[model samples]
Target: MSSEKQNLKAGESHGQCQEKAEEWMQSTKDTANAAMDKTADATQSAKNAAPENKEQAAGFLQQTGEQVKGMAQGAVDTVKSTLGVGDKK
Candidate 1:
């Protein structure tokens, strides 16, 4: 082939390569953006769920505290009776 024809062919090949590269880059960017959006949604969901978990934990702690108080009061009453400090009935 003539030198001019060879140069034209080379230019066309370079343009095609550049177009494919740009498309690949765009596709990669879109995939990355979608993954980021999903991650953000998951993070927000976790944040929203935390308050309910905290409330459940607080309720459990309150029940535990009440139980402990009752046990302590019972022990105190028993100790007082053993020491001959019972209230007259």
Candidate 2:
């Protein structure tokens, strides 16, 4: 403990040390506030985009379902063709 105190005295004066500590703390606080602001902005953007994203996803799913139905119909038609079941021939 005494060595620590000696080291402190040997380097910066008490006022200088206090000033540096205050500056460091201020800088840390500024960085934290900026991060918090960015997080808040990101959260708000996600909230705003949620409905649009949901609508887009729903549309995509609907298209995929339609494609699947078309593919199934095509497969059934192919089988019928091979069996000569439905064609007028």
TM-scores of the models, in the order given: 0.61, 0.77
| Alpha carbon lDDT of each predicted model | 0.97, 0.95
Q: In candidate 1, which residue pairs get closer than 3 Å at backbone N, Cα or C atoms, i.e. clash?
A: none
Q: Which predicted model would earn the best TM-score?
A: 2
Top-scoring candidate (lDDT): 1
Model 2: number of backbone collisions: 0
lDDT of 1 by residue, 55-80 (tens): 99999999999999999999999999
RMSD vs true structure, all candidates: 3.8, 5.0
Q: Any runs in candidate 1 off by more than 4 Å, and if so which?
A: 59-89
**Candidate 2 Cα misplacement greater than 4 A, ranges:** 1-12, 86-89
Model 2, position 3, has a per-residue lDDT of: 98
Q: What are the per-residue Cα lDDT tens digits for candidate 2 across 33-53?
A: 999999999999999999999
Q: Give the true-structure RMSD of model 1.
A: 3.8
